[model samples]
Target: MKYVALFLIFLAAPALAQDDPAVAARAAAKALEQASEQLDDADSARDRVKALTTTVRAYEDGLSAMREGLRRVSLREMDLRADLAEREAEISDLLGALMTIGNSEAPVLALHPSGPTGTARAGMLLADVTPALATRATALKEDLKEVSDLRQLQQEAEQRLTEGLQGVQLARTELSQAIDSRTDLPRRFIEDPVRTAILIAGTDTLNDFAAGLGEITQDEEPGSLPAISDRKGYLELPVPGKILRGAGEEDAAGVERPGIVVGTRPRALVTTPTAATIRYVGPLLDYGLVTILEPQADLLFVLAGLDQVYGRIGQVLPAGSPVGLMGGEMPAADEGLSQSGEGGGAQWTETLYMEVREGDDPVDPLTWFSTDKG
Candidate 1:
C-alpha cells in the first residue's frame, strides 16, 4: 500500500513528449533576442536613421515569429488536452487496477492452486505487463508537463510582446525625426510649387496630373539611374504586406482599378524597391498621401495612402531607402493577447494602393514588380 501511494504520486507529476512547438518557440525567442541586441547596437550607428530602420524591421520579424509560435503553442496544448480527455476512462481503469493490486496480500499475489509452475508463469507475465504500464504512465506525465510549460510560455510572452511593440514604435519615431533633419540626399530638380498647384487645380484625374509632370518640373532628370528593364518582375513591394486585391481585382465596394491593393499592419515601414527619382510627393486628389517614383523614362511607380512621407520631389532614393509609413495607430500590446491562436498574418486591416504606369497609361503593377515575397 505504501509503495502504491508513492507510485501514484509519481504518476501525478507532469512530464513531456512531442516538442514541435517547443522547437518553434525557441527559434522565435532567438529571433527576438537578436532583434533586442540589434536595438541596442542601432543607438551608436553612424547612420542613425538607417540603423533604426533595420532595427524596426528586425523587431517586426521577431514579433511576427513570436506571434506564430505562441499560436502554435496554444493549438498544441489544446490538442494534447483533448487527447488526454478522450483517454480519461482508460487512465482511470489503469489507476484502479494498480490500487486493487496494491491492496491485495503479498503472499496471495500471483499464487495459484496449480503450484510452482503456475506461479512462475504468472510472475513472467506480470514482468512484461509492468513495463508496458510504466511506459504509458511516463507518456501521460510528459503530456501534462508539456501543457504546463506551454501555459507558462504564453503568460511570459505577453511581457515580451509589450516590450517589442513599444520598441518598434520608438524606433519609428526616431527614424521619422532623423529623416526630417537629414540633408545628405541629392536632388535632381527642385519642385515648382506654383506650377504644381496649377497642375493639381487643372487636373481632373491622376492620369491627367501625371501626364503633366513635365509641365510641373521642366528640369526633371532620371538619366543617371539605371533602367529597371532588367528588374521587371523582380522588384519587391515597397511595403511589407500581402496582396489584398490583385491588379484589376475589385474591392468590397465593387470598384476595380488597374492597380493592386496591399493589406498591411498599422504603421508598417515603406521603402523604395529600386533606385528612383521622386516625381511627386504629398496629397493628390482623394488619395491621402502619395509618392510617385520614376525609375526609367516613361515608367512610374505610384504608392498612395501613406500616413507620413519622406524625401521631396526630385530627390533620388536608392533601393530599400525608407520612403514613408502606412496609416493607422499601432495597437497596444495587451490588444494582441486575445489573438493567441490566430497568427499575425490575420491582423492586417490597413490598406495601401500601389500602381504602375507607362507615361499616363495605367498598367498591371505585377508585370513590373514581383509578388513572390512579402
Candidate 2:
C-alpha cells in the first residue's frame, strides 16, 4: 500500500495547469473552439486575412497542445498500471491482513498470551497503527481513481483531436481564399513587365538577377515604408522554426549559401519580419516560388522555396503581414503522434531558404535577423 507514493513520479511531468493532462487538454479545446467561432465570422472582419490567419494559428497551437496532453496521459497511465501490477502481491497481502483483522471477534482479538497488562498494550498498539492504515488505504483508492480518470481523458481527447483537425483544415482553406482575394495593401510602384522579363532572361545567377533589380520598375516612386536599418539585429524570423543551416554552411555536396535555412512544420505561416515593399513575387530559375522584399533602398530580403506566393509585386506591406505558407499537408493522427516528445519518428520536413542582399552583395541573414526571438 505504501507503493501508492509511486504516483508521485507524475509530479515531474510537464508543467500544465495543476500538472494534469486532462486540464491542459480541456484548455486547449476551449481555445480551439473559440478560434472556430471566429473563423465563422471571418468574412465580416475588417481584415479577413488577418482574422483567418489568427484562427488558423490558434487551431494549430491547440492541436499541438492536445497531442502533447494525449502523449502525457498515455505515458502516465502505462506507468500507473505497471506500478499496480508490480505491487500486486504486496497489495493482496495488505488486503488479506485487513480482512482478517476486520472479521475477528472483539473478545478473540482482545485475548493476549501475557494477561490483562499485555492485552491493554496490544490494544494501544492497534490504535497507534489505525491512522496509518487508513491513510494508506485512502492513498491506494486515490491512485486507482486516477488511472480510471486518465483512461477516460484519453477517449475524450481523441474526439477533441478529431474535431480540432477538421477545424484547422477549414480555417486553412478560408485563410488561403481570403489571401487570394485580398487587394487592400498599397503598392509602392508598378513593375515594368518588359524590364522584369528582360532582367530575368539576361541573368544566369541570383547575383546577376539581383544586380539589375532596380531596372525592373521605372516609376520607383518613394513609398511610405519606414527605414528598418535600426531593426537589423532585432527582427524576428519570417516564420516559426529552427535554423537548420547557418550562413555559408556546407551541405553534402560541399556547396554553401550566404543565408541560413530554417526548417518548420508543413504549411506553417510566413510573415514579414519588418515593414517593407514587395520587390518581386514570382518564380525565378531553380529557387521555385520566391518573394523579394525591400525594407530600405539597396537592401533586399529574398525568401525562396515557398509552396504558394502571396501579395502582388510593388505592394508596401506592414510588419507581420502574411507573405506565404510552406509546402506540405499537416501530418495525420498517427504521424503526428510519432512526431511528439514520446515519439522518435519524423519531424519538421519543410525548409525555408532565406537570404539578405545589399545591392547585389549576398549577406549573412543571421546578422540581420534575430534567430533567438519568437
Model 1 TM-score is 0.88
Candidate 2 runs further than 4 Å off: 1-18, 110-118, 334-347
Cα TM-score per model: 0.88, 0.86
What is the per-residue lDDT of model 1 for residues 1-374, given as tens digits with 9 covering 90 to 100?
34344446546646445568767766777777787787788778888777877888888787777777777777788888887887677677666666666688867877877899998887776666666566766777787898899889877776787777877887788888888887888888889999999999998888888899877775656465778798899888888788888877787989888888888888889988998889999999988899999887889989999999998888888778888999887766546533544576666778889889986699989898878634
Q: Give the best candidate by lDDT.
A: 1
lDDT by residue for model 2 (1-374), tens: 24233223323334322366667767877877887788888879998887887887788778777777777777777767887787677667556656666899878877789999999987876666555555656766777998999888878777888888888888878887887887887777889999999988888888888888778886768644677888888788988787888889996789898877888777878888888899889999888999999888888999999998888888888788788889998776634542335431244578899999987699988888877722
The lDDT values for all models are 0.80, 0.78
Evaluate model 2: give its TM-score. 0.86
In model 1, where do residues sit more than 4 Å from their true spots?
1-19, 99-107, 112-121, 218-224, 334-342
